[model samples]
Target: MNLFELVEQLFEQYGYLVLLIGLPLDFIALPIPPGNSTLTYTGFLTYKGIVEMVPAFGSAFIGAAIGLTITYILGYKLGMPLIERYGKWLFIKPSLVEKTQVYYNKYGNKLLIICFFIPGVRQFIGCFIGMIRVPYRTVWIYGYTGVAAWVISFFSIGYIFGEQWQYILNVVEHYLKVIFICLACSFLILLVWNRVKREKAKKLSNATRNE
Candidate 1:
């Protein structure tokens, strides 16, 4: 069978086992779309009475938490040396520039909490925080909080909408709307941040020239 067929069959036969395996791999740097798919699949399973909603949520939560923690530790330990040795080799020196440094320097650690909820930044933040050797307890605090919020949000949607496909569709539609709204907000924030940084650089440069 093709890949899609294989996945469909897997979900049909052994959803819980498939989820437990896939989620961890996805979190630990595997190129897999585990996020929405797993949640949606679990909901479908619940609708079919193949799995209990509570059990599915709990298992997925633990799986995600453990998986993310592993990545966080790996990032903390391995990321810095690599970044230091050949950041430019990876085309990331621009982000490692003065502006990002200033942003990190000013934020002074609270960025960890915010970064955990943001999509692309979360992985890098885990690495940066890990490299800095931020306390394990602190990491766990924000990390678990993040996992809890994410799990509760998605699973509840699945559970509440589990009875009918149309209900599930509405739930997914709502999520899509929110995701797009967040995307728009992110774009606007980036635009503003870039503008502010440019103006600050101009002012700093003029002041240095005068001095």
Candidate 2:
């Protein structure tokens, strides 16, 4: 069956349990019913009076938080060690880690606030933060805030649009992908420029020292 049909069937069968289960899977990167689909459908059901708004939202939020916490704990306990052992197979050497650490020092913590809206980023962000040893306090503050915004925005879309939710969701997702692509390209360009600038400075300093 199609994705929409699958979600509708599950919701019909399990009610809020689906949210409690499905959202966690999505956050854990399994995404069987997909987080976006679940939230928007919850709002759609609320609009149809089949589901209570507050409870549905609460279930979603709690489920997401649980999943995020699990990933963080796993990363904290195991991620770096595993990478140090097996990262060579994945080409994740120490130099790569250092470069990533540099970028994370600059933008990673703040990125949590909007990571939920960034598609592929949302799934691994909690683990990433933990792997970098970012404090739980920072994750709780920025991460939960981002989750609230994400849930509210997509849920509002389905509720507000009502019968057109599926169409609207498709349109919204398409544009978001385009925007993310553009932003990723720009970020890469800036990174390349910064690297070149640093290299030039290093070479210039070496030349001066030799003279």
Candidate 3:
């Protein structure tokens, strides 16, 4: 059967447990039924009263956290040795890891906030951050924030649109990356502008004090 059909059946049979298990699996790149569709479908189920909204969100968030922690721990404990030993089988290469390192270096931890919105990046992000030795505290803060945003966005779509959820999801998937990039740029610009304004104010205050 198709993924959508599979997800529907799973949800029908298991309810909130589907999200509890499925989301974590997705984070580890298993994606048995896929994250986006699964989340949206969960929202739909909530709307239909097949599952309670609070528990559904809880299941999704906790599941994602578990998955992220698992992958991060794997990367942290094993480091490059694990990758070198099994990279070929997983299609992961040292070169790919090096490139990810460069990207992480350039972007810093802020990437964790938006990585889930991006496709392939989300699957490997926890491990990548751990491999590069970013502290778990930083990952926990930014990564969990991203997880909440991701779950809310897709789930709300399903809840809000009802029968139109699938159509809306298709459109969103097409433009998700571009939309997030624009938002990230705008946030950075605002941060820079605020910093400049603060610095100027500090300088003016110092000059007045000297006078």
Candidate 4:
């Protein structure tokens, strides 16, 4: 069977346990079924009376939290040394990690909320925050809220659309790609603007000193 068929079969057999266990595994970057697909499928199942709503939602939320928490803890304990050693395998470069740290420093933990809606970003935000040594309380507050909101929004899309939930997944993934592209462009623009501003300031300082 195909991946969707396999996921559906697993959910059929394992019910809430599949969600509870599977979501965290996804968050931890394991190669299980995609979490979005799983949540959407679970929501669809709820619409069909195959699974209860509350339990399904709870499992997704709790499982995501567990996974994110573990990633954060690992990042905190391991820090740059770990990333420097193994990050390349995950496509996590030191420069990317440094850029994330800079953004975190500027925006504080609130950025974590926005990160949730971004696909690849959500997976690494916890680890980046942990590596930066953000306080656990802040991480829990923003990170957990982000997870809850993200889970509910995606799950609701599936629940509402019923049989058409797969289309919603495609649309979301498309938008996430667009968002990342826009973010990359914006970051480049900001970098150029900052460099120009610094160069102008340096010239002015030097000219004034000579006067």
Give lDDT per model, in order: 0.64, 0.83, 0.82, 0.82
User: How would you order the candidates by TM-score, starting with the best?
Assistant: 2, 4, 3, 1
Residue 162 in model 4: lDDT: 94
Which scores greater on lDDT, model 2 or model 4? 2
lDDT of 4 by residue, 1-211 (tens): 9987787788778877887788778777773887777778778888888779998899899988988898899889987888799989999888877876776678756767877777677777777788988889987789999899889988888899998999888998798889888977987898789779999999999999999
**Best-matching candidate per lDDT:** 2
Give the best candidate by TM-score.
2
Where in model 3 is the C-alpha error above 4 Å? 83-106, 177-211
Residue-pair clashes per candidate: 1, 0, 0, 0
Which runs in model 4 stand beyond 4 Å of their true positions? 83-100
lDDT of 2 by residue, 50-91 (tens): 889898889888888887888888878888888899999998
lDDT-better candidate, 1 vs 3 = 3
Error of 4 at 117 (Å): 2.3
Q: TM-scores, in order shown?
A: 0.66, 0.92, 0.74, 0.86
In model 3, pairs of residues that clash are none
Q: Output the lDDT of residue 93, model 1.
A: 62
Off by over 4 Å in 2: none
